[model samples]
Target chain A: MDTTSYNNPEQGNQEERLWNYIDGTATATEKTLIEKLIESNAEWKEKYRELLEVNQLLQASELEAPSMRFSKNVMEEISRVHIAPATKSYINKKIIWGLGFFFITMFIGFLIYGIGQMTFTGGEESTLTKNISKVDFSKFFNNTWVNAFMMINVVVGLFLLDMFLSNKRKEFRKQA
Target chain B: MSTGLNDNEIISKVLSGDHQAYAIIVNRYQNYVFTLTLRMIKSREDAEEVAQDVFIKAYKYLADFRGASKFTTWLYTIVNNTCITFLRKKRLDIQSLDNEHVFATADNIDSGMRANIVEQKSKLAMVNDAIGLLGSDDAQIITLFYKAEQSLEEIAEILGLETNTAKVRLHRARTRLKEKMETHYTEEVKNIYN
Candidate 1:
């Protein structure tokens, strides 16, 4: 009986260690210890040989290659995802210019509305001192210039609201 | 090997929109991936599909790969999971040695003599059949250890098991395979000598 075998007689219990050994997963220290044991152990040596034979049989087995369309299919799926969206030059350019003009017009209109409201209110408060609450908009509506300005304001407000709503919808769609 | 770019370098290039850099990674590991998938799925069609899925998935998740381990290790983890999922969906039953005794015996003789012209083909088929008999975990352990050449530590990480556990699973799988082989051998010998 080999001395090493006498020391480690239960060879079957080391089957897991043998697998780790074949896989090169054992730590350096553990590997050295196992190696030293194998050197003096006949049973371990025999077990190692049997495992090596199986390993070789497995290695000798040929692996069949996948079909040529494999990579192509993968690329196709990836392309569907990562490929950039089509560039719409006309629509994009139009939207950019339209947004710029819309913002500028809104700014000017806001400034005009602020100034007009301040001036009109400041003058009306003093001019209509006699029961201003009872005063009606009939006279103001009869004045062509006042009515024309009011009508223009309403149209511009509606136009601005339409643009704002449309832009909001576009943003929502983009998020969706 | 010195001149070849490492996986990290290739990954950086890919992230920077060097789309073609992906081919390098694919070429470098395609065979390993193909072999692993083939061994696991056992069907050429399914294996090819799974292998391609693995590559595509690895490509998509490349940015999330934090370099905690080798790229091959990470990739095998994905491949292993993909095959396992496929196997579950297919609901393939484990092949039993008793059920396949006749074919297994013939295959054993064919494999033992190693002399038949179709020995390689038959042996591959037998292994595949035997692998089909094993539980999913055992089959995966056998493939990762023997076919993919993955270390037990790497397999542990992939399978979410302790290193010792992976080793034990591998040992058990091998023991089962050997027993299967032995039974087939005995049957074949009995037939021949009697």
Candidate 2:
């Protein structure tokens, strides 16, 4: 909301704008206009007085302060927390990026080198295709145990992620 | 990380192994945090626990404080959040249309409001009672805005509200506060007249 703009009401609907003026958020021109309007218009004057009274009352009372030992108890609790050192606490993004760059460069360089030195193990067949040709897919598909194991791992991973996310959500709610 | 330093500086010191420096932060912000918690929770004992937990959380996560906001604002966020979490866990936040927090502060005030101070005390008590009648969010907004001395923008950020939304809420809250004050004060006046 462009709240800083001067809102000169067109008609009988400037409550929000009037509130902005009362909140001291109105532009200078808007403030001048509001002051003039409050002076000339009885309704505006009454509304302004009501807002001013409420503002004063809200600003009047202070909440109760805790006992003298409040800080002491906090300090005692803080003494037990294991604070991580500054350097180790925040991860270095540069290192992560550098490692990523290094790995990518190495993979590309090795690929170029491997491609240059490549020789087909079978006539007109690359090493990858030759290797694929040697694998038997029938035994793996025929076995239900392998599928069950994979499904269990998937379910467990999902369960773990769900638990982790739920805990994170709870922490976030607490923070909010 | 200097020993005698500002809030961010003290936090840095605490982060950098000057554990004792946290005492400075705790001492400085305890009352403000306590006041906020006390208002929200409406009980001294629970407010005390919430206030202590606020500092502890701040201490534990001092490193995570991005310093995008003022330290007091950040600390207050913790205080408010802790109170809310405490309320939920304890399930003791029914409104009950009561004025315990209001009258409690009233009792604490102006024992020394003496003769000249009596009128002022009465006025203050009326206002305070009106404040007590406000909802937790409204009362919290009043406390944060006036007592904590935070700007509307800062309050918006603290309360996860848009600036306009916060302004509207504050305006409505104040309006409600005024109604409560006037209603109670009028009743008192009538009683006196009677």
Candidate 3:
């Protein structure tokens, strides 16, 4: 219950450190520090002994395994189930990133293709140039109806995307 | 442990159409899985049925396992989730963890009801009943740590918690168990060991 030496300003919580040591998750330095504390601090030692008693009681009794046919029964059930081939379908971060990369790459490819095929012809045919040498801003943005449709579709598309991502997350959790 | 065949290999074999290979997986995990379901459902017959369904479910979902952790961890997750789902389907009276508060407030509980509860249970059975009375988190950590002999890291993986958090939870769980034992088995614990 004493809070004085219980804290290590740099290391973190002393109670958590003591627990980590007991659970075998502590670092070497922490183990040494906890050991020293246990040896020198009566309260720490008592705490350790008290927890160890609880651990002993917990480990003392375990629930019994099922009947002898447990494995056979399990096997029977397994036999009944059709073993499908291992699926590469476990949705994970890497797969989602890969899919994103594929879509981005495809979009870039399609953009390049569209640009390559664009032609400006008056009398003589002229291939499309990456740099636009015309002012078409009025045509693109001057139409109120077109602009309104574009804006609405963008908003609706974003809403759809959000819904899609949310549903995918839920599916991932339920399957995972 | 079966002929040096790891779970991954057995899984691979099963996936490769060696359907019988799943038997190895089943045998390897049967006891531990059975004990877990039994503790959750508190009935051998129901536990057996749930345990079988769990295995069948595991086989069906084996393809979904990407081996992110140990096989036991994945299998136990399925076992735990399946048991929880089964409990939901049955709609047992123990639907909420808070109901155990009734046991905690022993003096408020009817003597007849408590007596009816303890009538057939032996000391060990009483111990198990006390554990069942623990909230799911505490009961699960105690089982995974002590009964399953899982390390703190494994328990964390099982519960999807950070290691430090799992350690704290395990400590708190032990404290709760101690309180439960002291409350319910104050006489029995002393008598059984003496």
The Cα local distance difference test for each model comes to 0.67, 0.69, 0.69
TM-score of each: 0.56, 0.63, 0.62
Q: Across all candidates, what is each one's fraction of true contacts kept?
A: 0.25, 0.49, 0.49
The candidate 1 chain A region of ten consecutive residues with least summed lDDT is A1-10
- DockQ-wise, the better of 2 and 3 is 3
DockQ comparisons of all candidates to the true complex:
0.11, 0.22, 0.26
CAPRI grade of model 2: incorrect
lDDT of 3 at B149: 73
Query: Per-residue lDDT of B1-194 in model 3, one digit per residue for the tens?
Result: 35488888888887877878787877777777887777677778998888888888889888877777678888878877887888888886443365355555875778888777666667557656677777766777778777877877677767667667988787666656656766666666555434
| TM-score, model 2 to reference | 0.63
Candidate 1 vs candidate 3: the DockQ winner is: 3
* lDDT tens digits by residue: candidate 3, A40-135: 998678667655655565667656677888777777766667756556654577987897677557655654544455443333434345335542
lDDT-based ranking: 3, 2, 1
- Candidate 2: true contacts recovered, fraction: 0.49
For residue B66, what is the lDDT in candidate 1?
Answer: 69
Off by over 4 Å in 3: A1-17, A89-176, B1-4, B91-129, B187-194
Structure candidate 3, residue pairs in collision: none
